[model samples]
Target: MNLRRLKYFVKIVDLGSLTQASEILHIAQPALSQQLMILESEFRHQLLVRTKRGVTPTEAGNTLYRHAQIILRQLEQARSDMDKSSDTLAGKVSVGLAPGTAASALSLPLLKTVRARHPGILLYLNESFGTTLSELIINGRMDMAVLYGDHASRGLSFQLLLTEELFLVTPRGMPMPDGPVALATLQNVDLMLPRPYNYLRKYIDDALAIARVQPRVVAEIESAATLAAAIHEGIGATILPDSAARIIAASGDGVQRRIVAPMIEAPLSLCVSDHLPLSEPAVAVYQILLELIADLALGSQPPEAACAAGARPQCPEQLP
Candidate 1:
């Protein structure tokens, strides 16, 4: 397949008009149309349907567009890796940290270590929802991500980092078990939780379903501040990973207790693309992250305590 034709098709689809794409690409309208025709002939499918106002991608065109985006990005990454100076490892590396998970705490350390050790590298950090981050990796927009779940995803590779024990957090002074709270104990407890799609929520729901326990869900909240505020206002209790629960409990908004009887644990994984290899700068950052994890022993302690014990600079802010 001609790479130039793929580029032309993508631009045409993006602008929704061949004429607009020709103008932007500095190609004559007829030349651009010929390229599109060649692409269609190669695929043996009508890639686009001409409408009165503009062009719309057919199903085949949409599939091709998705693939072309990944291909183009990978090519650009290859060029960037080749252009880097041999003396200094330098380039942009994008990493995503899923919100509300233990991995979110690594953002600061990752940034600091990269700057000190590999000053030439530019680190781009994304704190977004787990699913969105995974999608970005698959699309070649992000290099890697540290997020919850080891579930198999197409075009993605996973490395088990650590498992976070879930805790039931209640408003301060609320009556709760001294040791571990059982899933059945939350049957009548009003719960505030993230939406069902959230990885944390899915883990909690799966465990509850297995235990045949149904807790009354009062609201769905994705924001950490809002959830903490709601808990302080006595709206409802919530479940969270140990790191996050400890932070909220430490802040005096809630009291956290380990969940038991059927303990729920969220598995954290290092997610990268199976098809796209990491660039030099990305690999350097990856190694630093693993070293940080080992040094801080984040698996065994709350992030704050781990940071304190490791004598590392505190994170600038808590990731949502």
Candidate 2:
């Protein structure tokens, strides 16, 4: 069926009057009626039932109308997408990063890349706890996120990035306890963790629970800088991915120790809403962000080792 005809039919069904539809369409009532006749003849079915008040779609017509609406919508979307694809990628892309993800390393590099490669594209980077970011993405406020594993499945699609080791961060002067800290030892530590509502907190809480450790959370702070500062100021020790803790340790503010005894490696994922059809800019951002995460996993500066070596922030360029 012609898209033009489908549009006309849907409008007629919506207004419930051919005269009104003709007025809206700026077409003669007789011409509209003739088109309707041709459509009914082509289908060999009476599509609309006429009555004193107006016209209503028959069962077959209603079905066709529903399908027509979808078809018309798809065609409109196709046109919109084609218009976007015709030029250099240019649109606003919003990406969410949890406090524990190393957003600094990726944010600038991503902006730079978009500026250089797709000058029209603007990158909006949002930093929040995984729980908050997940909510934003699910509700369509944000487009995508980098999140910890346990938070992946609530109506969101996930692409596994890496399973990076977790670390116990202590004050700068605290003696590095030789090597990997056994996870069981965390039972006695006073932890300064993110709030209970944070996905990172949930992930740590569940793992510690399985280890049968009764965590002593001395404080809760959502900002990574503040969290690291707390540990540096000796407020309390806390757990974080080596990637997250690396910069803090390099700044000589905190010390990081790998967690062992059924190694605490939190799986990181690139997350997006399962229901939303990704736009061109969103897809570009996703691929670029994914590459950055992949670099973290396979790069020469292994997070656990990098922090110990006093390496600077692991930007994409610095990675092997």
Candidate 3:
């Protein structure tokens, strides 16, 4: 019933050992045990099951743990917000970005914007695969993450940033269609893409399956930069979002075409764990990224204008 006692109980569940939690909390073991017993008595339920291995939470304990995480996170956020200056905000924010998302689009712009605007805040960016980034966010290792789906996981809340169309990227000057390319046309094309489990790869595979088109996959890759470089080197072609293909094409070695006949658009989404409150600094970065995306959208020209010159999203080598 006591918040402080409940806080300690959550730590015990997290660390899986009361003794370890006691050491971290600087509370004597007997005192910690006494408070836990009192808490259990107040709740009138067996919150934890203890064995020689360690402690695990009961169903009721798990419920309390979830609520307690949100409570504590909110408490911390409130303290941070109060301590921040009216003119400037300062704190550490940890954000995870899926590999292709960061290298191709978000990372540099995010970093530059944060530096120019919230100079006092320290931003920690972790780049990993989508599933790994999702895990990091759900486990509280990262505050928020950018993902590529319209739907969110059980405990995550997602904001749709924009709908991004995927393009077929090839070596420069590769002959392609004059207009939108058919999805079935990729059947004979050699592909360099991320592994099957990757978000983009899975989407492409599913699309291909639906179209009854079996692509010739040459390599299973992880990094977007590598995927682009491989295609530019004539190793294979790849399917990429317009922004990513824009960055690659801007380098002057890649040519891209918009996929058609049931166009595939990977939704750019922002995901935050619903089980925890966002920190003040994380909130600032979130707003900034949203603003940047909005600015890019507003700056977009007409299709003819975009195509006459390559009008890639913000990167602008322009692939219509």
Query: Highest lDDT among the candidates is held by which one?
Result: 1
lDDT of each: 0.81, 0.71, 0.73
Off by over 4 Å in 2: 1-85, 173-176, 300-320
> Residue 66 of candidate 2: its Cα lDDT?
61
What lDDT is obtained when candidate 2 is compared to the true structure?
0.71
Give the Cα error of residue 127 in candidate 2, in Å.
Answer: 1.4
Q: Using TM-score as the measure, name the better of candidate 1 and candidate 2.
A: 1
**TM-score of each model, in listed order:** 0.80, 0.65, 0.67
- C-alpha-based local distance difference test score of model 1: 0.81
Better of 2 and 3 by lDDT: 3
| TM-score, model 3 to reference | 0.67
TM-score ranking from best candidate downward? 1, 3, 2
Give the runs in model 3 whose Cα sits over 4 Å from its true position: 1-79, 85-88, 102-104, 173-179, 250-252, 300-320
In candidate 2 the C-alpha lDDT for residue 69 amounts to: 61
In order of listing, the candidates' clash counts read 0, 0, 4
Q: Which candidate is the best by TM-score?
A: 1
For candidate 1, the clash count comes to: 0
